[model samples]
Target chain A: MLDLALKSIMRSKTRSFLTTFGIVIGITAIVALGSVSEGLRIQISEALEMAAGLIYVYEESDQPLFLAMASSSLSEEKIQEIEDVGGIKESARFVMDIAYLDGDQQFGQPDLFINGVDPENEELLVTESAELDDGETLEGGDAYSATIGYSLAQDLDIGVGDTIELKEENFVIVGVYKKIGDPGLDNGVLIPIETALDLLDTEEYSGIIVYPEDLDDVEEITDYINENIEGVTALSTEDVAITISSVIDQIQIFTFGIAGISAIVGGLGVLNTMIMSIMERKREIGIMKAVGATNNCILQQILTESVIITFFGGLAGVILGSLGAYSLRFISSALESATVTPSLAIGSLIFAVLLGLLGGFYPAWKASKLDPIEAIRYE
Target chain B: MSKTIIEVKDVKKVYNQGKPNELVVLKDIDMKVNREEMIGVFGPSGSGKSTLLHIIGCLDRPTSGKVYIEGKDVSGLTDDELALIRGQKIGFVFQQFNLIGSLTALENVEMPMRICNVEKRKAIKRAKKLLSSVGLGERINHLPSQLSGGEMQRVSLARALANEPDIILADEPTGNLDSKTGKEIINLMEELNKKGFTFVIITHDPLIAKCASRKLNIKDGKIWR
Candidate 1:
């Protein structure tokens, strides 16, 4: 019976291919869109990872968009108070925000992330990833120098010894950080905390990253900072990842909504093709029925053909969708270098199979119920 | 007494029973066939020949009478049971040489036996032998479209004989063939019948009617000896 169905499909190659193409398009869209959420979640989780025993403290007043918004800052006295806690071993101050070059501001070009790190904690809390890929490091008192990440240097077409104007202040490029595989870090510009504060016109640091003496004290220390510090929130590494995931969950719902449209059209395509094919093979079906094929046999044959078309469609869709996801990298520049790493999704294949079965049942049933005498006489 | 293989009892067939455009194709048809009897039905077009053949072949149920095959009354059988009985006992050869176009000659011959749950290796061997018996051995791999009209009929005959059916109901078996090719098919049927296979052939050809051991003519939805 399976062989017969295969022979029938091979007998009409063009129709079979055209029918399968509909499923292919739907599965491709599903896998491609699903990969975007998967890729971003992975990158964000990786970026959230740092030295394990550290806690990040941000000025808080119920601000949910932690990555982009920071309206207030922590005064030096507050940082001292947090550092004075029992388990703290080291600390670093950061002033983070979006920034554009002087020429970019004049031309209305977009801004890259500007990350300010305390010069005294440069080696400890900062530069924990790798060595400089180009040029020299900043001197202890080189207040106007900035070190950029690898992708930033490549994107801006700037290197060591070039002077960049940050607002009204001029800073020389000191070094370029090596590629760390995290897009957020790979596209950021790192400057001294004092220079960044002067340029942004802020008098204090926006956040403080503290390291505890014992890794086991992280949760307790986080709780202490949140409870003891005034108007502040302290998040551990896992907490930050969880927070980002909740945001991504909403976006994932949106992605699935888009993929849902493709599924309906693909299923309709299967239904239309199967019905037309059955109409053409009316006499042939009657012949089979007259030759001793039961209603169940006919039903299984048609359903088998449809399932085979969609199974191969799903297989092809997975490969094509992964390639589509990989193409997202080339267009990431327009998206401020929010790079995507393509990942294959197995769930989409299962969805395609279910679609095929549900879509194929009605046509198969109609075919199985056909009266042999009438069908054999059909023109 | 010879064993009665099939009997049609007072069968009246009505089409669209309650509708304004209703048709009554077969009225009060009665028939009986003993084992190994070659019965030929003679009729013109729309004279209920095919309709009678359909009932006798178990492809359809009678509208108001009973049909018995191999001494078993089939009036109470479900569609699936009737299908099984057809698969096991009745073989059909149509005027159009109704072979599945996608299957090769050997595969077409194997279809009924496969449906009857014949084992794979045995079915293949038997199908090969049946095709060779019908002089289609050389064209066993050919599709229905690849064969000539007469050759397609030969393949159709091999297919009808696949499961060693108790009765072969041929509805104008050679109707579509040229006269010369038609002669070949008629000769083949004669040879098969001489080997003791019962056949019921419906044809307008005077030769087939004469060739049969018995003849019945149907006209205007009634049958007469």
Candidate 2:
């Protein structure tokens, strides 16, 4: 029966190929887009863990979370109050903003943002994975010194001793950080806090980073700051990671939803193909019935044919989608930080076959229910 | 002293019952076919010969009568049961030489045996022997499209004998062939009948009908034996 089904599909080469192409497109979209989204989520989670020891204290506002993180509601006094919290080991006041840099293009786009870090608290601000690739770290009270991330340095075609213009200020590149696999940190520049204030013309710091003496002290210190500090919100690193995780999950759902729509369209293509096949093979089915083929046998044959179409389509899609994901390096530089290798999971393959089965069911049932005599008489 | 292989009692068939355009295709049909008997049912088109053959072969149910195959009542059998009976006890040859286009001649012949759960080796051996016996040994590997009309009908005949069924129900087996090809098919049936294979052939062709040992003429849904 399966052999016959395969032969029938081969008999109509163009129609079968077109139907399988629909499934290919759908599975490609799902795997490629899903890999990218999953890659972003993984990178974000890793970045969060990398900064796990630090709690961020910022002003509470009605603004969006990202904008709220960028604009400081914290004053110098608020920083003092956060530092005065019990169990706090160290604190850093920094300003961060998206600033256009005048340099060579990375991934055909200008460099992302600049972070203003106090030279005194540079050690606490830079993640542990970061290492100076060239030049030297910023010294206390260094005015206009900038450290560029590894990818940014490569993108801009600049190294130590070179200068990049940020918001009309030419800052000499003092150091370059190694590739840290964090996009936000890898594509941005780090400058002196005083220079950032001088350039952005803002006196208030964007936020304060507080370190706890022990892992157990993190939540305690966050609660204490939230209680003592007025009009400011203190969040443990875990809380921040959870928020980011939820946001990533939402994005994943949206991406998968879009992919699902394409898959459904692909399923409809299967349905159409199966219906046409049944209609064309009406007499053939009648002949089979007359030769003692039970309805179940006919049903199995049709379902098997549908599954074979989708199964091959799914395999092809996985290959294509993996290629698409890998090809991201040639298309975008941002993906270099969070390069996600697409995985062809067994679940997805099963899902594809199930889609074929579902799409082929009604048509197969109709074929099985056909009256043998009438079908035999059908032209 | 041959036992009856097929017994049809007071059979009637109606299409679209309780409707204004009702069609009564078969009425008051009664017949008994003995073992190894080649009974030819002759009629023009729409004379219900095929309908009666279908009822006797358990492919269709008679609306108002009982059908007995090998002394077992099959009137109220389920579709699956009917299919089993057809698979194990009956074989069908249609006017169109309804060979599955995708399968080769050998596969077509082996289909009924396979459905009856015959072992693969045994079924293949039987199919090969049947095809060779029908003078189609060289054509077993050919698809229906590759075979000539006479060759395709020969393949169909070989397929009908695949399970060594008790009865072969052939409806206009040579209807699509020219006179020369039709003669060849009729000769094959007569030879098989001589080998003690029971047959019920429905045809309007007098030449084909003359080959049967017994004749039953059907007209306007009634049979005159």
Candidate 3:
């Protein structure tokens, strides 16, 4: 029976290939989209862990539509009150602005972020992950010294003792931080808060980072700052992580919905192919019945043919999806932050086979129930 | 005084029963074939000879009355049980040379044995021997489409003999063959009959009927021997 099924599928090579191609497309969509979303989720969680036990106090309007344009800074009195919060261990006021790198056109129109942070408080809050590869970190009241990130140093082809111009003022790079894999920090240069205010002509800070005395105090400190500090919203790192995860999950659901539709269409393709095959092989089935083949044999043959087609289709889809994920560099360079790793789980292979079986069942049952006398005369 | 291999008693078949245009194909057909006997059923088109062959082979059930094979009444058997009997005790050759077109000659011949769950090596050996005996040894690998009408019928004959069945029910076995090839097939059946294989051949040709040990004429759904 298996031999007969194989021969029958081989007999109609074009039809079999077209049917399998549908499954291939469906499985490819599932695997590729699944990997991208999974990679995004992993990267977001990792970023959150790097900034763990810290809270961010940003000024923004309640309306989501205007949140991007709402950039009110905290007043000095509000900052003092937040510093006096019970569970707050340390607090840092930071200003951020985009600055062009001096004579670095390696990346077309190179733009680097300049962050102004108080050296004493910045060092206390900067996670242990941010290590200096060479030279000392910026000291308090250092007006001419700046610390460069690993990628920024590489972009300008400079290290410690090198000077770079920002806003027509030269500053020496006293330290180069090791790679942290965070895009914002990796491409930024850090300098003193006073120098940043002098260059940007602003005295107010953009945001503040607060660290709690203990990990368990993070939530209490965030609550305290939100209740006491006016015109500011305090968010724990975990809350930010959750918000990002939920957004990613929504995207994943939408992507999988599309993939599911494709898979269903693929199953219909298999069903169509099986029905046509049965129609063509009516006389042949009659011959088998007359030669002592039971109805079960006929059913098994049809199902086996469908499964073989889809199994191979699934295998091809896995290989193709993996190749697509690995070539993310061509798809989008932004995906570099998230490592796209395609997974060929055993569950997915089983899903492919189940799809074939579902599509093949009704047609096979119809074939099995055909009247031998009529079938033999069916031409 | 041989034992009876097939006995049909008062068997009748009706199609589309109780409908506006009901038709009875077979009525009050009583027949018996002893072991090793070559019985020919002759009739014109629409004479229900094929329907009788189907009932005798257990491929279809009678609307009323009983069919007995090897002295056991099979009219009440389920479809699966009838299929088992067909696989074990009976083989059928069709007028159209109904060999599965996708399979080779050897594969067609091996089909019945495989249905009986014969092991791969054993089925292959027997299939080769059957094809060789039917003069299809060199053509074992040729598909039905590649074979001539006579060669295809020979392959079908080899398939019929695969299970070493007690009764070979051949429905117009040479109906699609040329006169010469038809005569050759009749000779082959006669040879097999001489080797103690019983045959119930349905044909419209008097020349083919004359080859049988006993002939029964079917007309208007009744058997007239």
Candidate 4:
């Protein structure tokens, strides 16, 4: 029966290919888009873990995460109060903002993600800028000396001792940090807090980083600050990661909405093609029935043909979608990066087959119900 | 002492019944076909020869009577049950040759045996033997379009014998062929009948009818001696 169905499909090569093409396009959209979304989420979740053991102390606000993090002001007195708590492993003032360099820069994108660090703090609360690949970390009482991240140095052709103009002030690049696999820290620039306050014209720090000596003290510390500090909110890194991941999930759900529409269109294409194919072969169905084929047998034959088409379409879609994901990384680096997951590809493949069964059911059933006598007589 | 292979008792068939066009194609027809007999049903178009053949072949149920095939009452069977009887006990050849054009001659012959769940290797061997017996051994791999009308009919004949059925019903098997090719099909039917294969050949051609051992005339939905 499978052989007969295959022969029948092969005889009408054009129709079979057009039907399969619909499934392929739909699956490709699902897999490629899903992979890019998944890849960006992974990169972000990994980056979010950079603050794993530290607690962020800031004034409470409902702004979006990145903006809230940069705008949460903590004065010197507030930072001192948070550091005085027990189980504390030294804390430092943290200031962060988006900055733009003056004049021409390599790659033409002069915008830089900046973190204001106070080198005077023996324990740099923000551990991301503690290590340097070239030159030294910012010196105590350093003025206008900046440490840049590895990717920024490469993009802007700046090295240690080179002067970078920020807000009309020339600052010496004292160090370039090593690649830590966190895009925010790997591509960021760190400057002394005093200079950041002077250049950006902001006297107050954005927030204070609080370090608990023990990992188990994180919950107690966060609860203490949120309850006792009145206006300040304390959040663990995990809380931030969950918030960001849910945001990514919303994006993923949006992607699925688009992929689902394409899949529905593909299903309708299969329905149209199968109905036309069955209508053309009504006489052939009659011949099979006249030769002793039961209704179940005829139904199985038609269903198997549709499944065969989708199975091959799914296979081709996987191959093409993986390549498309790879090319998408190069074509549009909108996020951190894109990586195709095996589970997502497999899911798309299964979806393709289910699409076939859904679209082929009614047509197959109708063909099976045809009367053999009248069918044989149908021209 | 021959056993009855097919018995149609007071069978009636009506098209568009109880409506304005209410045509009765087969009216209370009675027939008996014994084993290994070549019963030719001769009739012009619009007669009920084909309808009677359908009732006996288990392709259609009689509206008002009973049909027994090999002593089994098949008229009361469901469509699926009738399909089993058709697969196991009866084979049919149509006027257009009715071959599935996608399959080769050998595959066409193998169709019924496959439908009946005959073992693959054994069915292939039997299909080859049947095709060769019908003088189509060399053309087994050729599709129906590649074969001539007489060759296509011969392929259909091989297919009819594929499942080793108890009866073979040929409905105007030579209707689409020229006289020469038609004669060849008639001669093949005669030779197979002589080898103890029961046949019910329906035709309007007198020359083809002459090959059967007995002939019954049908006109305007009634059978007469």
Candidate No. with top lDDT: 2
Model with the higher TM-score, candidate 1 or 4: 4
Clashing pairs in 1: none
Rank the candidate models, highest TM-score first. Answer: 2, 4, 3, 1
TM-score for each predicted model, relative to the true structure: 0.83, 0.89, 0.84, 0.88
lDDT by residue (A1-379, candidate 2, tens digit) is 5566788889899999999999999888888777777788777777777788789889987775666787655688877877777787787888887755545444544456788887877766776556787788777326888888888888889998898888888888888888766665678888988889889888888888888889788888888877877888888879887877888789878977898789889999999999999999999888778878788888988999999999999888877877777787677885543333534345456778989999999999999988888998999
Error of 3 at A146 (Å): 4.3
Worst 10 residues of 2 chain A by lDDT: A336-345
Q: TM-score of chain B, per candidate?
A: 0.96, 0.97, 0.97, 0.97
**lDDT score for residue A225 of model 2:** 78
- What is the C-alpha lDDT profile of model 3 across A76-180, one tens digit per residue? 676676777887778897877766655445654236778888887666435656788889788832698888888788767999999988888889989888876
Name the candidate, 1 or 4, with the larger DockQ value.
4
For candidate 4, what is the TM-score? 0.88
- Every candidate's fraction of true contacts kept comes to 0.54, 0.41, 0.63, 0.56
Could you give candidate 1's per-residue lDDT for residues B1-225 as a string of tens digits? Answer: 449999989999999999999999999888899888889998789999898989888888889998888778998888788888788788889998888888899999888887777887898999999999989889899989899999999998888888888889999987898889999999999999999889999998777977899988899889876
lDDT of 1 by residue, A113-196 (tens): 677887667644443655678876554438888887788889889888887666767788888878654554566777888888
- Per-candidate DockQ values are 0.58, 0.54, 0.63, 0.66
